[model samples]
Target: MENNMNGQTAIVTGAAGGIGSAVVTKFIESGVNVVAVDLYQQALDVLIEEVGTSGGEIVPLAGDVTDPLLAIRAVELSRSKFGGLDILVNNAGMGSDMVPLWEIDLETWRRDIEVNLTSQFMMLKAVIPGMIEQGYGRIVNTASAAGMEGHALSSPYAAAKGGVIAMTKAVGKELATKGVLVNAIAPALIGSGMLDQPWFDEKTKKQLLERIPMGRVGEPTEVAEMITFLASPSLSFSTGAVFDLSGGRATY
Candidate 1:
């Protein structure tokens, strides 16, 4: 239960959302210093205030995660504030339109890929060298069940997450012997504000729920628990693997 991660530092993107916040909370509870990243400074402020400094110090970095410079700033913050970075949670992502592939424009498609996949790549590029030098690191990326099953109307999102899965696998192997562990989690129908995203109409929501044999959406905390494990220093043997967080929606 105790990860002994008190002095470790982490950068968690999407740190203001349901699952992101839960992971941040769990990290703080484990005594890990956090550089919380998200879009809005106000939201980051609220999260920092809510968490306080009782467990561990949390520094907020608000910016567009898609901006490549944000990655540099975040890593710099981690190093300057907490000594060195030990973990990365690439959990920020978004998709809303329900258009089919043909109906999708190039800009929208590229945007989805940029937000869901490329930004994570930038982060990995920025953080990996430090981790390699320090000789220890953990990275947990948030993929989606849509990526694996290829849901009908969410092609770009599925493609991006699928890319994330593949990228994680490739990079994980690239650094397998370097003492860094990389992994992705694929979750289906999580009961977060994502359910409220414009694309998930009532019919779509019902159909999605029906696909999960558990007949309900997953809690954010459940996802957070697994993310925390992947970020732990104790996870030495596993790397470049995808972990399922689906509630019976993913049997593969």
Candidate 2:
């Protein structure tokens, strides 16, 4: 909530999505410039128009996070626009159909991994150098509760998110002494468009809501607030960790 970020800059993937847009807005409120990246041009445009920054600014870039060039372009925009990059939020992801692991096709399985996991790796690979050179950076990976508990009928999505958590730990330790902190957040049943997907029938949604002791889904703004702190200079001495945002649903 405190506006400590005066001249900081960041790149946020899935910036047009519910949680992603909220994260961008929070950063901008805290006086941090943000380069918002998403695949849909219309969505990016609509977001840019709606969420006009009050203090800092948002630079919307329409591109796929899976593309290697998109990562490079985002990094360059951060440097050129805001002088340097300070934070990177890998928040872009989607779920596949509600099918058993054995029943899913190979291509769908691979696509799930690419969008949910490999894309995060690619972004981190492109952004870490600038952070290393500066000796100060914050990286937040958006993981899912399914990854931790291995949700039924969403094996590919679960597997990819699990990989994200592990990768965050490995990279966080690798840069622990380098002044760049990396962490992940595992959220369950967020109240977003994700719940409207065809994979989530009324029964499926009800079953998921029952898991949260709070009896409700998490708000995107709540996740954004946590992300703002982790991406700020105030977050010291914590890295390679997983933050829980499951409304009391996280067992671990």
Among these predictions, the greatest lDDT belongs to 2
lDDT of each: 0.91, 0.92
* Candidate 2, lDDT over the whole model: 0.92
Error of 2 at 6 (Å): 2.0
RMSD of 2: 0.9
| Sliding window of 10 residues with minimal summed lDDT for model 2 | 1-10
**lDDT score of model 1?**
0.91
The C-alpha TM-scores of every prediction are 0.98, 0.98
